[model samples]
Target: MSLIAAASFFGWLVGPLAGGYLAQYGAAMAFQVAAVAVFLCMIFVATVIKETHKVSNEQSFLSLFKSNNSLTLLSHPNILNLFVLQFFSVLV
Candidate 1:
């Protein structure tokens, strides 16, 4: 499952190169084909993909942010100060 998810990202990256090549034919055809392919992929996932989480059988929107293990990540005090500085820099 992890491998397939990783490959899907790679596929997304590669797909546009093909689509860009196709676009040289016509902008309309390129978009139309991409839309059709995306719809087909949705159909495939709906029909074939299954919930395979080994830890728990929880399936919902909560499943999306499904980070299981929680630990005290803020053990270092400097990291929090760094985060605040980073956020403030982005404000401008």
Candidate 2:
């Protein structure tokens, strides 16, 4: 998890610097490069990834949304606090 976080932080820092270099070619070239990257990523995920989590027969995926389960989860104190903090941070 820490590795993922550190890599994500570095990617965010590096992406714009790399994009700026790509942008010198043309605005359209930058977008074209991004599109190809996304296409390669899609292919990689489709071929290499497998479902790891087991689903139970008793529970339907939509059960959370079918009842008030989602609303109840949102009303949890920790989640509610996180939402409030996020809202205020975004406002700033």
Which candidate number maximizes TM-score?
A: 2
* Cα RMSD for predicted model 1: 6.1
Write down the RMSD of candidate 2 (Cα, Å): 4.0
Q: Write down the lDDT that model 1 would get.
A: 0.77
State the weakest 10-residue window (summed lDDT) of model 2. 64-73
Off by over 4 Å in 1: 1-8, 51-85
Give Cα-based local distance difference scores for all models: 0.77, 0.82
lDDT of 1 by residue, 1-92 (tens): 99989989988997889788998889888888888988999999988998676656655665545543232334557876777788899998
Q: What is the C-alpha RMSD of each candidate to the true structure, in Å?
A: 6.1, 4.0
Off by over 4 Å in 2: 54-62, 66-71, 74-92
* Candidate 2 similarity to native, TM-score: 0.59
Q: Local error of candidate 2 at 19, Å?
A: 1.1
TM-score of 1: 0.48
| Pairs that clash in candidate 1 | none
lDDT by residue (1-92, candidate 2, tens digit) is 99989978987987788789998899888788878877997899889998788755576668745764655766689998888899899999
